[model samples]
Target: MDLTHSAQDEAFRREVRDWLETHLSGDFAGVRGLGGSGREHEAYDERLAWDRHLAAHGWTCIGWPEEYGGRGLNAARQVIFHEEYARADGPGRVNHLGEELLGPTLIAFGTPEQRDRFLPGIRTVEELWCQGYSEPDAGSDLAAVKTRARLEPVSEPGGPRQWVVHGQKVWTSLAHLADWCFAVVRTDPASTRHAGLSYLLIPMHQEGVEVRPIQQLTGTSEFNEVFFDGARTDASMVVGAPGDGWKVAMGTLGYERGVSTIGQQIRFARELDAVVALARHNGTIDDPAVQDRVTRARMGLEVLRLNALRMLTGPASATPGHEVAIGKLLWSTWHRSLGELAMEVAGAASLTAHAPPYELDDFQRLFLFSRADTLYGGSNEIQRNIIAERVLGLPREPKP
Candidate 1:
């Protein structure tokens, strides 16, 4: 929460800045500013190589413990690193679901064997991961998930015991590219709602697993429909005890709203800068309405930054606190509005694609992609419910 950085922190910032400046040239120069939420397919291979290069230099997962192949940095240093990374226009990371979400979950709840087996791959970018929580029927209400998994009966002593999974997960980002999926499946047929759920680490390459990319408004397929028809994984792949997955899944959600979001906010600021520059170029800055909205966006971004810091400094828990929901609501709404503002700045030109291939330009892509910002990662309604029930201690909404 300290706004002022100590000398050591300043030194770390310089280190990150210098490293990014030196390495983000030559072979990796083209990767700078490439790849993000809606544009995950952009420079796919190159961005991946850049991510691995960061790993080689001991830069990825700096917040994790040193024993777990990370720098084990404190919150301040992690913030510094992300800020510098964004300032340098570093490419969007391909392994965020692993390093930011799953790796932390494993370190918090996994067995030593699980950590040993998976952390290395995540750190080295040898294995990419996707979340299998949202379903066709359970997008926002994750507890309504119907995906099922049952144990394959052990044939003999020491014989392999596996879990046979059946069901589908929708809005599974990067599933087409992931090597594994950490899924929430109904482990007990009799259980309902949050009960009987198991968080299983399922392999993506085997038979019975299918990933069909979903085309988005941006004309990209980062999200996918993942069908698990009798997909099997080792019984040991479960993150928590059978039927205790709700807790573990919530833990992952908490991490999903973790410190890594600082980089995202920084990226938002960059987008705002671009929008402001566009308005200036197009003479829209002279309009009173445009000026008022632009000023409001700039103010909202600062408030968003401070809220993030406050959330970070507040109590840390395995499950998310109300702060997480508040943060989600704030950032998502702000980014979505920024997208709207970008379109307003573009005016008539926003309706047209650039050229032969008719690709969407930067503003067009931003406007299209930000439309989902409020809907994904839990919707605005979901966040408001969390704040109401959890923060204000209001009565829970009646279950359907």
Candidate 2:
């Protein structure tokens, strides 16, 4: 699949690496890094700054079509971008909800007006978006969403005729900081699951919308409980046709599981290197068993990076197929093991956030997040099922 870059691709890679190295200088200083690594108040713009910086140079949406503020680079360039960004320790892009989930869906299904309205903002980090799929009752069973969106007349005096939304959404990430949210609302509850749903882009700060952050064990308010009461949106806000929401939403999830993954997969590869460095410095490498563990971890990281690259090259369509399932599952399992290795390396220092004698204090926090890796973004169990039924063509487990 031409994994080896052509001369032009090589030149492009060199150019990107040089640009990123020069602009994103080492030691993040004010950056504070990704996901609040157990430090300060998160300085909201730290993430935003990174996205804007990338957009300003037209580097943020590298793989996007040139018509929509992108370089239209090839898959190889995309891989180079991910690799260089991680090498530079670049901060996470804040436009993720827009770029990763909403923007791509718009490109595939949106009207010209929809694309014109949202894509430019997404490029410049002007409009932020959050997903509103999960609800109080429909956490993993996404088709069970009860949020209702009824059509109405534009001039009802009090009643919303455009689209009156009445429902609750929980565990919405970045809801407070977002400009909009792409929600799945039930237009016809009587219809069977995965039918009669409408995908609507709701303005987050409007009158009927309420966003209250949900605190986690980490003492952070990253996720929120969002409620909508009489939330009125224009009929134009519906993504694709009313009853075709399930299909449109499938497009959204596609980008979420695939495109958004490029940067993150590289980031975790760097984490494995950190684990190896810790093991080497902590004197544990002197023990052959620990040395073998470090070697195994390194091999696992390389396999993940290579496999992700192979997947990216094969398809433009982003379905949650067996390859993605296997990649995610391996990443989660290997990541947790690396975290445990780091703990062993740091010993008592690891428990206390790795200070003085120990290096960076964030490994433990990463370890905690890894524990949830298998749980979030569709659990490992679900991935196993996909691999079994879809990839292996195995017989389904007998139903009760």
Q: Please report the candidate that would top lDDT against the real structure.
A: 1
On a 0 to 100 scale, what is the lDDT of residue 312 in model 1? 79
Q: Tell me the tens digit of each residue's lDDT in model 1 across 126-210.
A: 9999999999999889989999999876677667889999999999999999999999999999999999999999999999999
- Candidate 2 lDDT over 99-148, as tens digits, reads 76788789889999999998999989988999999888887667888999
Q: lDDT per prediction?
A: 0.92, 0.76
Per-candidate TM vs. native? 0.97, 0.88
In terms of TM-score, the best-performing candidate is 1
* C-alpha lDDT of candidate 1 relative to the true structure: 0.92
Give the range of the ten consecutive residues with the poorest summed lDDT in model 2: 32-41
